[model samples]
Structure formats: structure tokens, C-alpha cells
Target: MLNLLSNLICTALLSAPVVSEPANPKALPFEVSAYVTSENKIRVAVEKSAPESVVVLLRNSKNEILFQEMISKKELKYAAKLDMKNLTDGAYELEFKSAQGAIRKQVNVATKPVAEPARVILMNTPAE
Candidate 1:
């Protein structure tokens, strides 16, 4: 029974029609992601299966580049930690570029408000 099932599966797979490829590929050659950490820092990660030159940039709201780095083709996996302590709180942008295409990510940094403690009053005279 196992041998017959294996033969049937192989025959079905072989008889399946082959789909034509699209004129323009929708997927990018590399995968990239970025996010802001609780410690006021931005973390960027990239993964490219093939060797390719890549560039990473961090820009402010004014479109001014605050940080930039060039990654060699030999490095398949890339990770970066951007320190935003010195920079003022505002909207920022992170971009990853390669020969195939480019991708952009928005990063916002805003300080959280601190909550004030509640006030308490004592009534010692009434108790006495």
C-alpha cells in the first residue's frame, strides 16, 4: 500500500502544469526591517541570500542624513544599532538601498510624560 501511494503521488506531481513566471518580480532580493527600542535606539536588520552591496541611512525630518553606512557584498547578514540619545525627539527615517531596489521605514522618537505622585493630608488633631 505504501509503495502504491508513493507512485500515485509522484505521478500527480509530474502531471501538474508549470506556471509561467511574471514579467516583473514582485519580491525584493533582500529582506529588511527596523524598529525603535525602549532605550531610545533604532535597531536595523537585513538578510540577503546573495552577495550584494547595500547601504543603510538614517535621516531626520528635514531629509538630512544623520547616520550612513556602506555594507560590503560579502556580508550576507547585517545588523546595526543606532543611538538616538544625542538627537532631539522628532520624526526620522531609515532607508536601505541596494542595486535591485530601496526601502524606507519611518521612525518617531518622543519622550513620555512622567506621572506626578498623589498628595496626602494628615489629621492628627481630630484623632486626639
Candidate 2:
């Protein structure tokens, strides 16, 4: 019975349609995200449609604005970066608003600084 089941499964899988081509996703109207560094440096990215006025703001957990900037889109696309340092480690939000739309992204700066991790552990490793 196990052999029959395995043969049937293999047949069905081989007959299944193949999705070899991947569809490209459309970009959002606006986006706001932050890239935090372990050295306590935060780089904020704001992307939006061209020919629109965009307001970028960084606020603390208490909704107090820490940084604010206004950008006028005079090209086909617009992107802005904010280098934030010397800020106390805490939760914050980066906001991008315009006549088109608004996007908010959270920024978590735990007391223990952290950035992207690229290392992985294998199960075969000996227990320390």
C-alpha cells in the first residue's frame, strides 16, 4: 500500500502545473521604513509619488515629533533619507504623509542595540 501511494503521489506531482514565471509586485503609493544600525544610527527612507508634497516625521512613543521635513517632488520619483543619531533607545514611528496617502512604520530600538543578523546555527553542532 505504501508503494502504491508513493507512485500515485509522484504521478500527481509530475502532472501539476508549473508556475515558472514570477509576477512582479506593484509598488505602493508611498512607503516609510527605517534601517537601524547596531551603532545606534537610524537611517529612515521615504518614498513617494512624484509631483506631490510629502511630509516626513519621526515621532517618539508619546507622539512627540523628534524630526520633521517637507519634501517637494520635482522629478519622476522622490526618495529621502534621514540619518538619526543621539536618540534615546526606545520605540518610535516614521510617518510619511501626502495628498496621495500616508504610511507609518515602527522603529524599535531596544536598550540592547540590534541590526540585521546573517548567521545561522545548524542542528548538527555539538552542544556547548
Q: Which 10-residue span in candidate 2 carries the lowest summed lDDT?
A: 11-20
Poorly placed runs, candidate 2 (over 4 Å): 1-28, 31-33, 75-84, 113-128
Q: Give the poorly placed runs of model 1, Cα more than 4 Å off.
A: 1-26, 121-128
> Over the stretch 1-128, how does candidate 2's per-residue lDDT look in tens digits?
54333322221001111121222112334444556543345555656544677777778889999888887675334455444444565677777666655666667554432334699877787789
After TM-score superposition, the amount by which residue 115's alpha carbon in candidate 2 deviates from its true location, in angstroms, is: 19
Assess the local accuracy of residue 76 in candidate 1 as a C-alpha lDDT between 0 and 100.
91
lDDT for model 2 comes to 0.54
